[model samples]
Target: MAVVLLLLKTVGVLGFISLLIFYLKKIRLYRAAAKFPGPPALPFIGNAHVFVGSTEDILNKIMELLDTYPSPLRFWLGSRLFFGVCEAEQLKIVFTSPKTIEKEDLYKFARPWLGTGLFTAPASKWRVHRKLILPTFNPRILESFVEVFAQQSEIMVRQMKVEIDGDEFDVFNYISLCTLDIICETAMGVTMKAQTEGDPTYVESAKRTFEIFYTRMFKVWLHPDIIFNNTRLGKDQRECIDYLHGLTNDVIKKKKLELTFDSPIIEDTKPRKAFLDLLMELSNEGKKFTDEELREEVDTMMIAGNDTTASVNSFVMLMLANFPEVQEKCYQELCTIYGANINTDTVITHEDLHRMEYLERTIKETLRLFPVGPVLVRYVSEDLDIGGHVLPRGSSVVIGILKMHRSEKYWKEPLKFDPDRFLPEEVAKRHAYCFVPFSAGPRNCIGVRYAMMAMKTLLATVLRHYILKKDRTVRIEDIKLKADVMLKPVEPISVKIERRKH
Candidate 1:
């Protein structure tokens, strides 16, 4: 009986201490941020709890929460304070000063999967790596990848033939494999077995990596002490990253041998035409690039180049399936433009993409409605004067990118998936900072042109050959975005396809 009494007393004391700690955290952190409009936070956890469902909806909720609380909205995530930056003026202040006003620590949690790649590295290294690799991504050579883009896209079209008989099709896996193949070929100079021969091992690893990443980011600790100490990555996440890098490194080594050839792309004397080969050339005869630097740049490119493009494709496939009229329009345009020669060997030039304005608009509209990366973040490196106030050092300044895409100030019908809104003349009227499918300021996505070309080419080819119709059970909002590396539908983007009219 005495022991039972002692145990009850211990429980009471623990509860009291928890309350006391909550009080101190509120007073020290949130009260200090009370100047900003925001929802009241619980002791340790903040808005992090609301991220349990579809990726886009979770971002929509974040946008709603910010709208409810306006600019400089403050909240907590496990005793840590975070601010949701809404005002355009404040976004400029933060994005333009990535060297000072912010860093990319949001990716710290992603390190187990991506190492110190461009997204995870510090400003100094990122700059060096950026400058060194910038030339390889030059728009001039971007035309070269068009054929590569067309090839893999045709492969996807061939695969879709089996499901084109009014049967439901899950596009999430197909689009991922397509982009994975493209990136593996173009970025690493090697084609993944998954895309070429229908192997599922690489595909499974990639999906599991993303799942574990999400779990680590949101799962509440079993106890308090577990939160404060260094939280190491799960074994699976580490293995996934290792396998990805090992595959890339092998490809880079193989591509280096052909750099001695005069022309990287010629009729008879074959040379490596991939971006990885380009990086190898710069690494060998360079003032700045070393072996390690070369690997890091390739690593960054490989990781960034694959998932985001795939996510965009996955999103558009779902949208096209749901909107039959829009899908028909796109299909008709493809017939007029590319005719019937859309296959794995299709070699489209950059100029060809420019002619497909309707195609571009469809891709742009998809990005506005369902951005592959919904939120863009930065950590304040120094004191930043934003909007009306100054942010202290070490503070994080986050932009609701998906919110801005839907901001009423920028669109006539913000929620509608109307591609016509992006007409050349109409595009000029929108705010320069708004509509950031790839983000903006100096840190705007460098792969913007490449991503656009790749996506448009694939979409045009698909529309040319097949008519996409959504499964009756799927709604636009019903497609949950379960994302880790990049945004993807939580459920498969199931659609029925029919061979298009010639």
Candidate 2:
């Protein structure tokens, strides 16, 4: 009886002490946050509850706050208070100003997958990888990949073969499938054939990865027990992540085995132009990227290059379907440059790609409406001040990209879908960094040029063959979204397409 009574007393005492500590922390946070602008947060939970389910809502909150709050809105996540940085002038401070915001914890989630690569690697490793892999983005590689992209794009055109009076069929899947194949073909020297094959391994894994990605980001809201135990998101995420690891391991194993017998791997066997081949060649020379290192880049390329870019292309088609006049302009632009005889056999060259300026503007507008990476996060390594607020070290600051895009000061009719805003003169008038679909600074997407070329080539090849119209089922505004890693349409985006009889 005495032992049981003692145990109960001990439990009560521990609970009391924890409560005391929590209250003390909250008092200190309240005092620290008095100088900044934000909604009052409760003791332990913080403001994570304000924006749930969709990051679009979080983006909306950030947007509302951006116009009202100064550049930095001091907010809390548990006991830690962070100053969210938004203004373009301040972006230079955080991204370029080496001393203040030296570390990036935004991509910490990716560390498990893409360890110490250009994306999230430490300063020293980043320098080495950045320099060594610099040649991958060279003109030679870009040119070679363009040829590969054009070839795959032509194959895409050949795959679509149905005719009807002006009508719409689901083409988002088609574009996604093509890009999926293109990335693999160019990067891995493997053909996915996702368009022709109904259930391709790579494409399925890519889609599943997005779902898993959303779960990882979204589950931050629920109570720890709810999130980890007896939840669909948590359970399924493990399987998907495991599958991704398995795929990368398989690819790495294949590459290593090929390297043993063949000098260039591609030269002795297939002569295929692949990122793996280039990395292997460099490894053979002197710079050997370990299996894990190569896996990091390969996984990054798969997710970054495939999922987000495809989502934008899907939205672009949806926009084109809505505005036939814009589609007409894009078509006319292509016809003027490529001429009347363009068909499945047409090989789109790198120089020819530069001429399609109208298509480029349309894509820019699409990116504006549905920015793939809406929020950019950075970790403060030291105390910093910007736009009248002081941010301490280890604060996870998020830049609201979507809100900035739609800000009244920078954009007129911020919600409207207008391609003319991106005209050479108009674009020049705006701040250079205002339009950042690929982000900025040292961590900006390296595949921006590759994505643009692929988007243009495929748009040229596909739109030329079909008249695209929006399906009645999926409207422009109402198309639901799962806002997590990359914002994606919740349902399969459908567009009706009729073959253009020449």
Best by TM-score: 2
Off by over 4 Å in 2: 1-30, 54-70, 99-106, 163-167, 221-231, 263-272, 471-480
Error of 2 at 108 (Å): 3.3
How good is model 1 by TM-score? 0.84
| Residue pairs in candidate 2 whose N, alpha carbon or C atoms collide under 3 angstroms | 168-495, 168-496, 168-497, 169-495, 169-496, 169-497, 170-495
Query: What lDDT score belongs to each candidate, Candidate 1 first?
Result: 0.70, 0.71
* Top lDDT hit: 2
Clashes of each: 4, 7
What does candidate 1 score in Cα RMSD to the true structure?
5.0
Worst 10 residues of 2 by lDDT: 214-223
Candidate 2 global TM-score: 0.88
